[model samples]
Target: MSGPPPAAVTVHAPLRRRVTVQGVVQGVGFRPYVHALATALDLSGNVTNTPEGVVVEVEGDPAAVARFCDRIAVDAPPLARVDSVHHQEVPATGDSAFTILASRADGPTRALIPPDTATCAACLGELADPRDRRHRHPFVTCTHCGPRFTIVTGLPYDRDQTTMAGFPMCAGCAREYTDPADRRFHAQPVACPDCGPRLALLVRRADEAGQPSPVTDGDPIAAARRLLAGGAVLAVKGLGGYHLACDATDPAAVERLRHRKARGDKPFAVMAASVEDIEPLVRLDPEERALLTATTRPIVLLRRRTDGPTVPGGLRPAEGVAPGSPDFGIMLPYTPVHHLLFGLPGDPEGPRLLVMTSGNLSGEPIVTDDAEALERLAHLADAWLTHDRPIHVPCDDSVVRVCDGRPLLVRRARGYAPLPLPLPLEVRPALAVGGDLKNAFCLGAGRRAWLSAHIGDMDDLATQRAFERAVAQLESITPVRPRLLAADRHPAYRSARWAVRNAAGRPVVRVQHHHAHVAAAMAEHGLDGSVPVLGVAFDGTG
Candidate 1:
């Protein structure tokens, strides 16, 4: 038999604490979640977005307040990533209710903004449902999905600070935006067909004077698919930038794209409608499948099916797609527009797979500016399927490969920019200008280092200009004002030269390429130099 519980005693004193959270918290529904948590715990508090990250205040019983702080990261929204949370007891403010405050822009921005994510399951369901107002809408998004770093032009990541500012929300969207119960509440890129970015298709033709004339008019996705089926190359505007796409099955089309772009044997990435579509052509392990379908949607390199047909045979990818390589770089459709290209559910006549290569000439940075694409890619693209949503940053598609059942990132961009890498040791504000070949610069302060998105080879004049622009954009978002500069030791490397020329009054530290590579590996593993580790350098340079 259970005895009656003793009478509960009420605590008279109220406890208060302030918490400062860092990393990928802004534009990710952090404040609302904090509000809900604080309210549920019967705590009177306030939450606000700050440059350093989210700031929260809570006044309640000491135990409840502690639990509230502990569960913040554990119960954070799916898209909200909490890197670090710090709390300190403060004097009770005698608050009565929980509230969310306006964002503060005055602090040094150490807060890491999240990278763009793939369309979430909820958004995808709405995209395919005929009854949903956002059905087949190209720019459909929610708090758990859609653009972030690439679309963000300035700090304090809000709709007005992003490219989506041009499109105002309709009454329906506005309702969802304010409704706390709605998934899209406070989603920066939330919009619908009533007020959202629209696609436009343009075809190039020679005028009577033999000058190129671009004629714009068509149902963009349908027209682009039609052009692709007809062996025509289309320049497609993607989340981060443009992509040159064509039917992967058409050898002639692949060869034409290669010849026009002056690309050598470097393989192109193929975008399939789904994993089911590409399963027949490639061998996919559990890890490879996960990488392919991940929210980041990076191109994953997979071993080709050399030993005859796969389990469920369909059609094989054209030989021209990879040339000499034994692995195929593949990715699934990430954006709603990409899903539109393949058509809804059963209406099938279009190509199953597309050769989606970065939209640029061989040695240039990927094109993000629409006007520049028209002029520079005129010789390569026969048609253009573009949108009004401007990309504030030009980021190439990230590339990765599964080696020994683990993901190895080859080129980190697009879905992985502005996210800082944790360093083994704290350092002062410094900018590391990586080698000219792959040319990815890093801005570091304290223990966090942010690597710029792939800037392409710094040899090209256009690439150099792009490097400067990327640096400026990165500096705007990250509060690291580089007081010291670091560059490769190679005397003539363009990146090193750029460091010398642009160092202003800052000191430039030259690091040997081989030494730096060894150091990087050590740092990644958090080695403290207590023991000797063998390192081999094989960069292929004499």
Candidate 2:
């Protein structure tokens, strides 16, 4: 208490206010955190994540009201990302204890879904503690990370709305999840090895005849690591989809993976066990290392190490590992599975490093289904490290780099895409059709713009399906019946075609590809075309 209340102080009557928070405020454990805070402060109100942002209505004692707004942000949940909040006073009606309300349509423009974050320091410490049940467990996760947009199927991110819906939580984990003081409180993805999703290995049943099928039932992650130890190739499912994995040190394994995947030219990314392991394979300046290790865990393109062998035809069939390029895309393991595969320092059968590449038949969307990955990647892979967790959204790994010392996003998936960007211009709540390659769409309202996770090249039918599903899902959360729609000028753009096909009830704006890009940059930098500035528009075929 900051001194007892003044004896003569007449506490003003409590007022009611409706608050709207914009930015990446959904699917990151925000509503529950607010509920907890409000309950503790004895406030009566509710908060919900609408397509626009989080909408809140609160009424309580004057001091509690101040604390409600002020402390909520400071003590915000670890995974929740708050950008800007707007609140307005309204009529007050008597109410009970504050609670989290189900998300409803508040305005146009979808709230940005926070990207998957890395495990928190606290959770990691617990994972490494032998006294803990999940000590050194590979699948350990908390509110900070594990999965978010990648695993969510709908809004109001609850366990039932996630891939974890199938496996019911064990009694102990469930208890911790409900305890207010516990870190796992209301944690949607919480589970122990006993009640959590299981792992299984998929191998080609008839080798040359059929697709891959799981041979072993339990612990596919651990089994896959054992196979990798023997220098075998295994296709593993990741946050977005499947990734082809092999021992990094085994040149034979790497080369084999390339030949099987029919990759003629395109560099395969290497996942060093740790930041220290990366130094030998590539040169990492202090800044580069910092970006690589950030919570985003983006694949970073770094100049290759002078010590490693140059691209050679004789090298493991990674034939196209580098085509028309000089940089190598490298990243540290972002998921708990990747962490477990490259076992911590003391674990036996620990792999010092591994080669992890997208699971696909070159030029295809990453694989998500166990049967499909086996059938599709059979030759390219020796075995499958499959899990029971179903992927709701298919996002690829996001890649980035420092060009001229500024961060440049390359792939824009896993931990970046789907997170809304702040825009300078507030359009009539609309959808900004993204480009054809690494295709991602943006929906917005007010100053906030939500970008969908990377949708991959529009050429593949699978990618097209993903694009359609993504659009519907975003529309559900950001509830926008855009009075006006926007698309690219290019006639061949699948996105443009989609816009044309879907514009049954609205006005359509066909913006040139580069124009939208420039406009987006301008919006982000707060530029209002008062002064002329140099701009470059590049298109090879146009």
Evaluate residue 536 in candidate 2 and report its C-alpha lDDT on the 0 to 100 scale: 74
Give the alpha carbon lDDT tens digit for every residue of 25-62 in model 2.
Answer: 66666777777787888889888766577888889887
Query: Predicted candidate 2: what Cα RMSD to the true structure?
Result: 4.9
Q: List ranges where model 2 is wrong by over 4 Å.
A: 1-22, 35-60, 86-111, 136-138, 207-213, 217-219, 307-325, 444-446, 505-508, 513-525
Candidate 2: lDDT of 506? 79
lDDT values, one for every candidate: 0.86, 0.74
Alpha-carbon runs more than 4 Å astray in model 1: 1-13, 206-218, 309-314, 540-542
Per-residue lDDT over 161-261 for candidate 1, one digit per residue giving the tens place of the 0 to 100 score: 89989988899999988776787878889989899988888788767854345445556677778889899999999988899999988889999998898
- Model 1, C-alpha of 292: deviation from truth (Å): 1.0
Question: How much does each candidate deviate from the true structure in C-alpha RMSD?
Answer: 3.1, 4.9
Instruction: Determine which window of 10 residues in candidate 1 has minimal summed lDDT.
Output: 209-218
